[model samples]
Target: MSATFVDVEDVRQRLGSFGVWIAPMTLLTTPVATQRAQFARIESLGYGSLWSGEPPADSPMGGREAFAEHGVMLAATERIVVGTGVANITRRDPAAMHSGAATLAEAYPGRFILGIGGQTGDSPLSQLRAYLDGMDAAATQVLSETAYPRLLAALGPKTHDVAAQRTHGVHPFMQPVEHTANARRLLGPEPLLIPHQFLMLNEDAETARGAIRSVFGSDAGLPNGFYANNFRRLGFTDDDLLDGLSDRFIDAVLAWGGRDDIVSRSRAHLHAGADHVLLHPIAHDLTAAVDQLELLAPLLHN
Candidate 1:
């Protein structure tokens, strides 16, 4: 399989060293102006891209439609790239996803990326293959020639192969820097690798960890869970899996401490071969998330 999308390097440059991942805009009934304002502020702070996803409204992270939010964010900022860290494939048909993504890419030009995932198929790869087929069939000439970047929210080799062959690369969330190293080895140094890092500005380990747990811990340890399976693949123990996650597990997955600690953590992923690391600040609301990023900007921005 060969890649139809070929503008990977340009996308990498636009992503810079760190981009933010949050759903504060669509998570609430926040005014569009406010959404634009917050996005503008982050761009002004010198962050490269701002990533978000299409989570269900009732989801613990709060729901926001990916494309709609991407549009608003794109309209709000002039330089910062906006991406759907993933728009759930299970939630929309291929044609709809293609149309929405193309519209954004055309409007935003090189500033938008159509990162997609969240498949519920029995045969995950086969299911995603079909999904891409539908999306491709629906593609327009402008979109095909635009070469707007795309990615799969993949964590393992199989899906990484799919991403390498089809889209630009993979966006692995909830994994550590080691996962970035392993993904780089799997991708063999060309395909784009953007891993999401959970960050908290809290000083106390327990408080910071508790915030991450409230967001991702409940879904761990499931026999059929993707994140739990990814954890095992990364060599975390069953002991690390049980009892609200071992301290080691929490430490590996979440970056918490002073400015230097968080900055070093992001650098670790970049050193591990990630082209860009999407920083997910563990905050209860948009205001807090934005404030945290501002505090880290002095050390984090490239």
Candidate 2:
């Protein structure tokens, strides 16, 4: 049997003209209880989807029972879709991933979205294609039992094509709006085109730059060399990398300042052809994140 994508009408309803991307609550930082609260709050705030991750440190197969904890969050809210914006493909055997994503979809019905990604390495293409094949077989097996949606956390042509041919859409991370335009052109009109936007609500030059630097300093030169290299292509120099994100680089990559400023930057992503925008607040403070969401809620509607 062929693999099943998400039901278009169902996805459209869940999207309801507003799509959201949220940061994953990592094991070190946000606890499950805290994650539940945050997801519930974001759902109340009118965001459409809550996205999280299964990083390398976590179990690779992306457990279905893990999301079961968030059942409290899902139960507390209505109309929000919950996604594993990427549970890495390399971490799990095909059957394990299939069972995990399948269980979540069966349990939640239309509310679950499974997003998959390839882990970083030299032979990423070979590994990613194999992962896609496994993911397809998994989806077929699960969708035979029940319907669910899947997406790929894609950055390049090959994965984007896999997402187009196999799943519902593509969710590209840390990419600029121009990338969104290019991805839309690649994925065409039918699939979901959700992009993650990092933001800071402070306009103070030093404070914003410090925040961006702090965030990127921790992330750059990591295993994901491609993402860092892409930033270089976007004009980040060695100085920018060593000193951390320059003001220009920060401004180029992140949306910063007050509500109006953030919304204006987000509009560019939507205008560039994104079907949905997920906002990742760079702030460590939860209240600040919530406040930013409150401020950005109006923009989500438009």
Whole-model lDDT values for every prediction: 0.82, 0.69
lDDT of 2 by residue, 1-302 (tens): 12654566668677654444544443235565666676678888788877666555354333333355445445656768777767667567766766776777776778877777756677876776677677667766654666667778888777778778777888888888778888999899888888888887787877876775664464553223667666665556766655444566667778888878888888898898887787877657555576678778876666
lDDT of 2 at 175: 87
Q: Against the true structure, whose lDDT is highest?
A: 1
Output the worst ten-in-a-row residue range by lDDT, candidate 1: 215-224
lDDT against true structure, model 1: 0.82
Clashes of each: 0, 1
List candidate 2 segments past 4 Å from native: 17-20, 25-28, 57-72, 139-143, 218-224, 232-242
Error of 1 at 119 (Å): 1.3
Inter-residue clash pairs, candidate 2:
21-278
**Model 1: residue 7 alpha-carbon error in angstroms:** 1.9
TM per candidate comes to 0.92, 0.85
Highest TM-score against the true fold, candidate = 1
